[model samples]
Target: MKKFKKFLIWLVGIILVVLIAGAAYLHFSAYQPSTAANQAVKVAAEDNQETFFKAKQNKLTVIFYPGALVTPNSYAIWAKKVAQAGYTVKIVHFPLNMAFFKVKAADKVVNSNENYVVGGHSLGGAMAARYAHQSDNPHLKGIFFLGAYPDEKGRLDQKKLDVLSITASRDGVLNWSKYRQGKKYLPKTTEYYQIKGGNHGGFGSYGQQKGDRKATISNGRQQTIIAKKLIAWLRKIK
Candidate 1:
């Protein structure tokens, strides 16, 4: 009997160690903002650790979630560009830097008086779509994804919300098969854009990510293209 107890204790200890090591890997694997993106963080406003970038507040707001293992500040450059075009943007900071942990976190950021949209990059975008699919918030007008798409459960074929999907021609990190399958989940009115020569990491100011294809275009050029697309989408939301 004593031997069995000892074995049980040993097994529990090994499981704990493995869990701790896995957590540490996730922490260390987070993508950090580049110097320029880091510097831009200074202008951002904070609400309970969530970051906001609004040069001029407007009737429309965008709530963004970071991709898995991506720091929120990594998206400051993109947020700034959208904000400059007269929209308020809030970037959610997730526990463990993963958006799936807080799929409906956008609820706290929405205002009944303002028209709103939710979006994100990579896995963040998927989680945002999950929230959008299940939410009944009347203020939600649209959703935009950056190199990401919804899973089966986030179906929006009958939803009234507008959808915009932006992808990179050179992106190797995104699952193309899943992207194709995700088309059935989007509304009939969904719009799509692809950035030529851009890679997955170019969507944000973070440096190249592991397992992503090399981008043939400069980050500035890629960002500009994304900004233009976002601005054009925003203009149509009214």
Candidate 2:
């Protein structure tokens, strides 16, 4: 018993050390928002601090999460366009820019009385799916993913929620095998779309990622497609 306890303690200690070291590395190496992109935008929140793009008059809201190590501002430019299309868009900024730190962070931004959908980009998308599947919030009408998918344990196969998944044709950064495996976790009504010639990093304003392929389309062009898809999806749900 003593030997087993000691081994367990050592194992936990090693895991914590690795997590801390990885977080520290991400803190310094995280991708920053492009300076060329507009930095000024409307900020609105009841309790949570976030970047919000609110339509003058709107009923439904779409809460977005940033990808791991990505700045919330990276998504601001395109979010404004989506907001202009009608629905309110709120981008949640997570601690260390990692949604894994707070999978339920959207809870603070969500207004249960109002209609809403949740989605995220990359790691953020995966976490958003987990939040949508785990929460009993009836107002959560649907979810969307940008180069992301749900995890095995966070499956939404039995849920009635609408799901949309957006992927890039030239996205080398996404794990194709894992994404394929994750489809079994989505609901039967999930919709999938791909942006031709776009790379993974084009989903946000951030410059090229280390492993991502060079995008054939400009970032603005790719983001426009993403905004169109989101706007269309929101219209369908409402």
Total backbone collisions for each predicted model = 0, 0
Per-residue accuracy of model 1 over 37-82 as CA lDDT, tens digit each: 8887788887665898875657589899888899899888878888
Q: Scored by Cα lDDT, where does model 2 land?
A: 0.87
**What's the C-alpha lDDT at position 108 in model 1?**
74
Off by over 4 Å in 2: 1-24, 39-48
* Candidate that scores best on lDDT: 1
User: For candidate 2, what is the TM-score?
Assistant: 0.87
TM-score per model over all chains: 0.93, 0.87
Model 1 TM-score relative to the real fold: 0.93
Residue pairs whose backbone atoms clash in candidate 2: none
